[model samples]
Target: MPSMKNSSFYPSYFLLVGIPGLEHEHIWISIPFCITYAFALFGNLMVMFVILVSPRLHQPMFIFLSMLAGNDGLLCTSFTPKILSVFWFNDRAISFTGCLLQMFFIHSFTSIESGFLLSMAYDRYIAIYNPLRYSSIITSRLILRLVIVFLVRAVVLVGPCLILIKRFPAFKTNIIRHSYCEHMAVVKLADADTHVNSILGLLVAFTILGVDLLLILLSYTMIFNAVFRLPSARLKTFNTCTPHICVFLSFYGMALFSFLSHRYGKKIPPSIHIIFSDIYLLVPPMLNPLIYGIKTSLIREEMGKILWKH
Candidate 1:
């Protein structure tokens, strides 16, 4: 499409190819996607609900849990429905503005979720290393401030990428080979040189994921130091950090693989890339509630009451 005088020419809609070679197998494909999406959707909602209703669970960790759930809800919903529609109903027409909105929500929520994870790690550190001052340090006011900072950072980082997309004077193709309007995928379609957009993207991603992972590691290092020095009851204390560790691994482990695979794993299959990306987005939300419910005794007890304590 030709550029309209001063503004970029965004096509009316972009066609998404959901799982390049699995078009005919979409029915079989939808099964796992549906199941994962179900858990990701309802499980997080249940986590938030249980946290909200249970007063004993009113603490910094659970507060972060609920916030992470909500952000996961945003992150997953940003594009999964559209991806499924492209598969199930062949409804692949996403408007230009809508695609940009999807991209913004997905990226921003992802960054926000990383921030929450870092906060949760800090909460764990406080709860463990300085139990005497945990309540004082991880107060509601601190949580509110942390949330504000994360939201501002996400908007400031991702908003510019979207604006840069709008500045693209033309597009080489209106068809995105993948499901969502991923930043690089969308930028690659622009007719102009988008190296600045691309470079900024890598910088932003490293700033969010890279920094968060490093700080999380540092927090856990301090946590382990504090845990081992305990005179006794070390096993139980170590167990407390298990759920968070599992959640952290599930998210960053898959995320690292997917990011690396997409960027450097050229010899790997495309299906692997697609499936891996989908799993990280969908699986973490599904697993988080279950991990916490099983590992955290307080939450487990309260959840049992909510479900079976009639």
Candidate 2:
């Protein structure tokens, strides 16, 4: 067997050179990532500022929007540097513990994001179906409680799951064939059978993304029914949902593609897999604030006011 020290010779398996492996190292792609990163950071930060500094945005709608923006900010920050390094410096190497932490945070933030989306859906549902009771239904105390529940679900679930994964012995190659440390990428390098890990991972992903999405869809279905019942109010209610609808479709559509591709996209071109997987993480953060902020007049006006002040 080749010594671990000189193990870089297996360049053929480098087909995807990193997790969600790629055909070739398109280092030039960093140009676009840099642009997207800048935009996501700026847009999310602006949303946070507008919501915090402007008292008008302190309502449940903007409160959840702020949380969503915060999740996007942290989500992108968690993996962008590693991706940038891989593309720029060929620093594809990642320590085992570092990979574990990356997996944990990525999964955690993803759960939190899904939870926030659910909260937003509920907010809309209440606003439309029970406008008079909406305030009481989604009070400050209840919002805080929901936030805590959402965060707890992510941290508690992901933390122990990572611990379980770390129990496996690391006898095989430590190389991850992807831009960033991903859950499956790390497991693929395991010398031991990872069937249990894979099963658990899928289960957890289903609970967080799959189940949350179903609930979100149900919430929207109810919201749509309520909106349709109000003949004159349909336009205004639909306008209110346009941004969330765009975000929901983009977030879930790309997510499903990534999940399905990772599972069954093995025969497909590695380049396509890489690009699609990247979009799963990169596109949502880049467009979320724009969809939720710029598309809404209130958010846009508040952002303008904050910018003008500062």
Highest lDDT, which number?
Answer: 1
Backbone clash pairs for candidate 1 read: none
The TM-scores, one per candidate, come to 0.95, 0.91
Candidate 1, residues 52-167: lDDT per residue as tens digits?
A: 99999887888999999899887888888888888789887788999999999988988998999999899988887877888889999999999999999999999999999998
| Model 1 whole-model lDDT (C-alpha atoms) | 0.87
TM-score, predicted candidate 1 vs. hidden true structure = 0.95
> CA RMSD for every model?
3.0, 3.7
- Superpose all Cα atoms of candidate 1 onto the true structure and report the RMSD in Å to 1 decimal: 3.0
Error of 1 at 36 (Å): 0.6
Give Cα-based local distance difference scores for all models.
Answer: 0.87, 0.79
- Model 1 alpha-carbon drift over 4 Å, by segment: 1-9
